[model samples]
Target: MEPSSASFIHLRIMQLVGYTQLYYCPKRQNLVRSNILVVYSIILCMVVITWLIYNLVDIEAHWRSLEINSVMETIEYINLIGSGAGYINSIVQSIIHCDKHLKHFKKTMEINKLFKQVLKVYVPWERLRKRLGTVAGGMFLTSFAATAYILMIALYMKWYYYIRYWLLYRILYNFCSLRYFESYMVVSAFKWTFDYLNKCLQELSFLGGKHMDAYEKKNRKFGLYLTEMNYQKQSHKNSVYFRFKILRNIYHLQWELSKVFNDIFGLSLLVNIASDFLSFLTLTYWMLTTMTTFSMALVDVVALFGFLICLVPHLLNLILICRICYLTTQSVMVMFFQASRTALFVHKIPHDPTNESHIMQIEEFSLQLLHQRITFSAFGFFNIDMNLLYTIIGATATYLIISIQFYLSAQRG
Candidate 1:
């Protein structure tokens, strides 16, 4: 298989986050790195986990000591829950699923090899590399800026009481950001593969149509016509059979790859989405509470800045994940339709034992596509698609209203 720019970028980023130690060694056609790095990765995860526990306890105590209103108190709790979820997700990715990550990485490489051999599609590695680099760089910069701004604000506000907690939270948040970016690249790769499959199916449809048109245009005597008809029928059948067979294998491989992906990332996705949702809820609630209690002109600039820094990244990350999942699923649907259309075209041709079997293969392929749908989900709880985004927004709004009501009641009392 040719070099993949996305894979290279993903590996580097994953390494930086201590998610994996393996690097592609082209000569060996395998991922190679020291087992010691794996041990180091485990140690890093342990350290992060330890710090997260300490920070959570410290922050909780600090929030309680503030004697804030009910709404503010609730938001603080939600914030801790969200941050905890994210930390747990990082732990799961780096420690528990470490071996699975290695196995899936190798499996995907093998699948890519098969795709190249079967489909013969040209992937623009250089273009992909530049695009992926820009995205990764942008995410890193945004995360860095957010961290730096918060640290600066902590200094300004003299938040010495929980400054350590903020530092630990930022570190954990950056790790989560790295994982999110890596997942995006993986889904993007899947999207690219599905697109190429769709293109292959389109070309197959065109070839079938051309065959049908040529057969109709030919003129021959009755006896000669019968002979030519049989020959043409057999030739088209053979061509369609070979192509469909290759496509079937590719589709099956894709299905297995999806399973591997789910195994590796399913729980992590669940917690990541949960973390983002909770964080978004907490930040939006805090913003709303501040606005209701004080005029915009009188709002604390440092607090407002903190809200923006936290809110924007979580919101953008949520949308990015949903959009990619939706697009990848759409590509799979397009492939399904193409296969169905190709099968219908084949059905119109004269039937023989060979053509009959070809039609069956096509039908089976279509059915497999429908039955074994390719979807990204949060451990089967809910799909990670655009609809999920809408659901999240609606849910957040509902909770925000409830929290505000509680605050109003508490003030009255």
Candidate 2:
């Protein structure tokens, strides 16, 4: 009944599901007031979309008229819009999925209070909140710095023809940056989920020992402790019940979280992966081409390095998400194996603390754990993890090489 880390995660999940806000039931005024914000947001989104489409068309025409070198010069600045497009698409997908996710999560929570409570207990909110705050602050600073640097470089270069283009690009950049903020939310959820599962594994490991300890205490003292033995036995029995309850809840929570991940983030992740892939490829191409002068080459190197620096948070986010999800699966597997060992050991020990019901429930939980599957996939097409990251990098490198070869061939022709 006490608030646990799992409870905190459920609170966050509710916030994302929109049941707390979007469907807040009260006076009619509350519904109207809540919807007013949604209406305002939709209007602003329409404006941004119209503005971006116009600029993208104009820029594409302009770039076609420019020489190859001139086109390449803008590649670094312009392809950012592509990343922006991905981010924008992701935000849109989130909006589309919001209601459905809300309905699904709301129904599940109503039906399963124990799962909600257990899920929240493992979140470690103090540490997670602090880390989330730091991540947000860093992202804000980086965005501000990057914008200032772009403005300065534009003024120094005095490329008036591209000034309008730059402004439009930055506008898109600002809009797409929302994707990162959204990502921060998703990653934070995952961080809490993975951390909770690890805690569950620890609880599972100590479960059998606790039972054995209680049994040993009763035997060692014999009739002298008979009065205390009943109390201790009941207490330990409750403890075993609580631990098994947590294990059962964990399996259910994983399924719920995976559904949340798929509904709310599937398209968004696809957008992010594609956007990052293109950004990295563009940076690589620019860095490799400026070999004619040391100063020019030095500038390219710096640009590439700075670009990569900016990308570190996003890249690290991807890797951490994958690692946490993957590790949680492995941990569950370990827990299942430990349960088998405990069951075998329990049979060997006389006067076991656990009742037949406790053993039956655990065996059921272990079987469920075997069948459980959890993954963060983009649009259900591919799982997002370390393996996906490696594949993206390899694909990007291959394409970058091919594009360079084609460009050389074009120049010769």
Candidate 3:
């Protein structure tokens, strides 16, 4: 695989985290030794927390009395704890299952070779690379902007409060937030995988429509062509069959991946999504309802920009995965529809026993597609397509309305 290809994203991430050791180190003693890095991360979290507490707790009472300042500090601490704990937890689990999971992933890739087929139709690798890079870059830039704003706040408060504590808080919070960033990489990889699959399905739709035309147009004598067309019909059938086989293999691989990462994904996403939604709603509430000084409002505005940077791209990543899956399944139906139309056209021509095999071939390809529709589901909860997108939107709207109501009631009180 090319260095920038989507298929290698997961491998690169594993290598960065040193999980690749589990794959190559055969001896049990080496395996155990290699896992020390993963284990060390969990221990480091504790050490970091201790260091943060030692510095932070020594801050003056006057700083803690500033409600807005305190609220922001509390949020930062909560973010730090949430992301750090989640990362440590996931790392521990991954380390425990390191050998088995890595082995399984490798064996799956070797045996199925579905990724190779995906690359066939998933042309223009540059587009995939650019799309992923743009989204991820936007996310990191927003995060950095937010961190920069936080630094300004720290610097501003340093004169009045403890400079050392502010610096410690800023550094620790940003470090821990890197965990959520790591989770984004995994989600982005899955999104690209499905997207590539979707593109392949679209290509298949075109091929299905042209299957007969290409076969018929092949150069052969008039009488010889008629005879050869029937035999070539089988080739079209085999081509359709092979495409479906590769698609089925992709679905299975998706399942295996989903299963392996379900807990980590489910929990990480749950926390990230929940936090993001709350941040979005709260940001809205802060903007619409609360009055503040111009400087504080500027802080809010910059923070809002940062939050959107992180929130919008990540949400779009999920939405795109859903949208592509929806489109791919619909494309399969379109393929079937076009094939059926071609079959009907084949029947319209005057009866010629010489053409019987070709006619039957078209009908069979259409029938196969009609009966075996492709559906993509994420961990079997529900299909991860436009339908999931609709559900998420509906839920978000409902919560936003409720939050607005509460905000207005508080204003009245």
Candidate 4:
């Protein structure tokens, strides 16, 4: 089957923005792309890295020249440093792990093919296409608004300041956004697969129910002394064997897909989440300080608007990622429960050697579900879920309290 047009377009956008070095060629069954783009991406990243280093020197010099007046300034400085580090880390990781990335991408494509061709799973490409369009449009509009706001504010600044704030920062921010978009797509793929797996399990239960119902009806028709017909028993046994085997194989493939996903994107996620947390902390602190201490002047109002522009996209990205991860993990747990229930249902049936083997297969699958669980995490440091969101909120509150105390102390002094 052909790939979804929307997915193809989304990936091509990634390629245009230097997020990906190669695109898959379905006809060739391999990743193929011009080396020119690869070279260009490398050069572009190198230029950005050099520009960042130059800006760091300026930041350090500016830091020395200025007095740290408030906790807000400290938070601002930290946020800037964290953002720069995140950009550099993402770029460097992409370059260093280029081969690993390609390998994993190919593996992901193969898994997708297996689902379509061998397992006969239905992927809701239309829904996914709509989602991709909605997310891309939102990111574009948010980035555009932020860029325009920066441009308006930077008009009076020096040439370098205008270029740094308006040009370089926009580029870097878009790069980070693309990385987040990529993660969203990958996670969505996993979530959809888990959904289909659950559906398959449900159908298996229904199949068992139908078989039992047929056996009961036949016994009533043929008199209570009659056993189930030989052909009917063998046919149900065969159907059960095939269905269980397919599900088991699909679950195993899910494990492989998750591993490949982590290998390709784990470090990038870690960096992205850290950058978001720092930005969230800084923005919250700034807004709190502004609201409590400062009067509502035009200048403050404009600054607040700019802060909102920055805050919304970052917060949205964070929440969307965590929410999807949480949903995906929940789906996996649902699959586990479904598998356990199916196993129990099979156990209560009359025992034959074939039935005994099917019970063992299901029990083994249940054990694997318990032990070899799938989780979305940031380089094994923490799982990406609603819990992570809660942790961020709690940590931000604690830090804000500390900063507020210092702010109060400074005022008194």
Model 3: how far is 213 from its true place, Å? 5.6
Q: In candidate 3, what are the lDDT values of residues 112-149, reduced to their tens digit?
A: 34556543553344665676577657656755665565
Candidate 1 C-alpha error for residue 93, in Å: 4.0
- Candidate 4 matches the true fold with a TM-score of 0.87
Write candidate 1's Cα lDDT for 1-413 as tens digits.
24566567667767766777777787987777657767777777677667667766777787778764666556655665566566556655666666666676676666666666655656554665576678888887888888788778778768776567666666666667767777787788788778877887898888777776667556333555877787877788677778778877777777777776787677777887888888898888788778665655523766787888878778878888899999999999999889888877776666675436767787789889998888888778988899999999999999999989997797799
Candidate 2 lDDT (Cα, whole model)?
Answer: 0.59
Best of the two (2, 4) by lDDT? 4
Candidates, ranked, TM-score: 4, 1, 2, 3
Model 2 earns a TM-score of 0.75
Give the residue spans of candidate 1 off by over 4 A. 1-6, 25-27, 32-34, 56-81, 160-163, 219-233, 296-302
How far off is residue 340 in model 1, in Å? 1.9
Give per-model TM-scores: 0.87, 0.75, 0.61, 0.87
| 141-198: candidate 4 lDDT, tens digit per residue | 9888887786776563332443453465566667787788788878887887789889
Q: What lDDT would candidate 4 get against the real structure?
A: 0.74
Off by over 4 Å in 3: 1-33, 48-81, 96-104, 111-127, 157-229, 282-289, 292-413
Residue pairs in clash, model 4: none
TM-score of 1: 0.87
